[model samples]
Target chain A: MEFIFVLDILGVVAFSISGVLAAMRKGLDVFGILIIAFATSVGGGTLRDVLIDTDVSWLTNMTYVYVIIITTIFGIILRNKLNYLRKSLFLFDTLGIGLYTVVGVEKAISAGLPPVICVAFGTMSACFGGVIRDILCNDIPVIFHQEIYATACILGGFSYFALAYFNLPQDLIFIISGLIVIAIRISAVVFKISLPKVY
Target chain B: MEFIFVLDILGVVAFSISGVLAAMRKGLDVFGILIIAFATSVGGGTLRDVLIDTDVSWLTNMTYVYVIIITTIFGIILRNKLNYLRKSLFLFDTLGIGLYTVVGVEKAISAGLPPVICVAFGTMSACFGGVIRDILCNDIPVIFHQEIYATACILGGFSYFALAYFNLPQDLIFIISGLIVIAIRISAVVFKISLPKVY
Candidate 1:
């Protein structure tokens, strides 16, 4: 649990930096950049909590708020260095989504939702923060037409349920599920893979 | 209460029809159209309910589901005739926002939120459905750039609180706030008015 918490914080930091980068490219003011960072870091989890009728974590947890704010500050000051760090940023984002996918599925299970809904929640947890950020920035969500992002999260969720059914160690199932997401995303980007478009 | 219920149904119908039109123009398929219709009709209220930590109305109540489905069917079947009804369609859309602004303010009050937050909630409820619809269709939201739409809702919310402070009847306050929204929208369109952009 402590390990997962640390990964989650790392994910938030990576996502916040990405948000700042995107907002800066759009020429948004500092306030706008902060909001974009907020939306990117915690938007998915907030949506999942709302649907499951739980208290929104960021509203009660000051840690996320502080982390994102601090991250945005650093991202802005170090914007010039970010270009050199793209590869590492991508790695951090993949890890973040992997952890978030497992976290979302676990929360859904605790809420007593059905299997399909749990998988949907998992994907939502990992993907919708980017979706919300893209929407705020007036772009079509990358997952909708271009990336294999949500697919990786969905597959990881399926693996989690499958491992649990086989009576695997709970910690093993969690780690493997997250690792699968990370592996798939990294491979997709490296291989220039994408989802096929109907149009 | 019955009158409010009737108005709410009308608002749902109007928003759903608008959603259908937007999807049709975007060349979305039947399934896509239905999803857009659902989002535009209930997305704002759902966000509000989620933030307030209340039972999401559409999840528990079948009325909204039935209303949007029926509205979409009619909207698709009568798309050609819809052009002739542009004036009436705009009227319906305006009325819908007016009702939603008041409904959102009322809900925030019930949740015991502060006045400024209530106004923000009111504007969000009146605008975010269309915002979501536009985002899904990959367009910048109209309210974000050119329209005075959200401003009307915010002002109406302020009016709601002001009237309440004066010890006006609850029903009167509700009706007046809604009327203010409708009037502002109509006047804006009639005079070709717009919100000034910083750029």
Candidate 2:
């Protein structure tokens, strides 16, 4: 339970940083940066909650919002030292994808959805914010244009269910599933792994 | 029915023109222009359909996609020559809001949603695409940032229901309701009408 909480915070921070980086790249105003950060951190989860008729997670917990705002201010204040920030942002984003995919799948399962739908929802919860950020920045979503993004989350989700079916310990299942996603994403970046473009 | 079909087609063309002009202003490539045009034309309705769990209207009608593509290509080819595109784009956007507000309201009412929800659904259907467009451009959504954008759609929707209650001629009610939205939007733009900014 405590580990879940920690992972949730990491996920929020990761998403917020990614949003901030995208906003900085666009040279948006401070307010715009905050707005984008907030949206990126909460948008996917909010959409998921709304779709499933659940209370909005961020709205119910002020800590998530506070963390994002604090991180945004910190990122802005340290804007000149961006290289380190970029690396951290990528790591955090990948971790968030794993954590969020787990939570989203669990939430859907609790809501009585089928396994396939749960996996789809899980992947959506992990990746839709980045898609929204890219769309808002007038760029094709990285997931659609580049190496495995949602694909990693989706595969991780399926792996999680498979592991659970085999009676793997819950903690080990989570750790292994998350590591798989991170490994896939990192290797994709390192080796330029990408799907064949249809068009 | 024929009149309704014509109005729907006109709305698509008008919205597509508005999207093309917006993309041209951004100096996007042909692919971007086509994407923006299609999104602008169908985005709101698609959102409405998704939210209501109905079949996506435009997917069933490939003509919508074809129309947007043709319009986008035309806009790109005539980019340098279309000095009056700005004025024309505004006109079409206004018409789009008017036509779509009615379409959305009718659909919602037919679906047995309460009146207030119907109004919200109608306004959302009219404005979501432009909001999406602004977001994609890495700008605050114009609907959220300034002007009486969604307000005009709401007012037009109210007029529609009111006219229906008064047993007005169905066809005349359509024209009157749509004209009201156009007038409101035009006035808002010309007079800089907007809600008070939140602090």
Candidate 3:
């Protein structure tokens, strides 16, 4: 539980940094940067929660909100240093998506959604923040066409159900399923793995 | 109520046609066109419903879905004929925004949100579909910068509250406020009205 909590924070930080980077690339002002950062950090979860017809977490819980704001300010100040931290950021991003996918799947399962919908829920929760960011930045979503981004989360969703089917301990299942996503993303990036281009 | 229903269907058709134009401009295939059309038609209301934490209307109601699908087909078939119908399309679009704005505000009011947030909700419900369509087509949201588009919806929202404050009948307030949005948009376009450029 403590481990998941830490990963959740890491997910928020990773997403916030990504938002700051995208907004900066677009030359948005400080307010735009802040808005993008907030949206990116919470957009996916908020979307999933909305689909589940529940109160938005960020509206009710301010921990992630404060984290995103502080992170945005730090990212702006440290813009020059971002290049040096690329590797670390990539790792955090991978971990963030992995955790997000599992959490989304778990939420859907708890809500009694079907398996197909559960997998979709998991993938959207992990990826939709980037979708929102790219939309606001006026780009075709950067994450959508990338082979590994959605594919990794989707496979992570599959691994989750597989783990559950064998009746693995729930905690162990989550950690393992999340790790599978992280591993796939890392290995894909390291090896330059890609699916055949449809177009 | 029946008039509102007709206006709602008209809104869907207008939005679908706009989506088709956008997707066609981008040279997207038929599938892409269909997806974009559907998104444009329901994207805003779906977003509003999501924010209000309710079961999404389209998922529960098949009427809009069938309307969008049929509209997309006709939009494609009449692509060349659309040029002659530009005036009609513009009128429909204006009326669409007008009706959408009031409906959004009324929904927010029924949900018991604060007035300011309700106004924002109304504007978002009238505008975000275009935002989604543009994002998908890789353009800055076309509806956002247009002075009259959002301004009309916002003003309509204010009109709703103002009329209610004065103890107007609910139905009368809805009709009057919706007409205000339509009037604002039509006049703005006719007169070439514009907000001064920020940059």
Higher-lDDT candidate of 1 and 3: 1
| Prediction RMSDs, each to the true structure | 6.7, 8.4, 6.6
Question: How far off is residue B12 in model 3, in Å?
Answer: 1.4
DockQ, model 2, C-alpha based: 0.07
TM-score of chain B of 1: 0.97
Error of 1 at A30 (Å): 13
Most accurate candidate by DockQ: 3
Least accurate 10 contiguous residues by lDDT in model 2 chain A? A190-199
CA lDDT, candidate 2, residue A39? 84
Per-residue lDDT over A150-199 for candidate 1, one digit per residue giving the tens place of the 0 to 100 score: 99999999999999999999999999999999999888888978988885
The segments of candidate 2 whose C-alpha lies over 4 angstroms from its true place after superposition are: B1-46, B49-107, B110-199
**lDDT tens digits, residues A31-68, model 3?**
45765787788888888988887676664456886799
DockQ of each: 0.13, 0.07, 0.14
**Clash pairs detected, candidate 2:** A136-B135
Q: Cα deviation in Å at residue A176, candidate 2?
A: 2.7
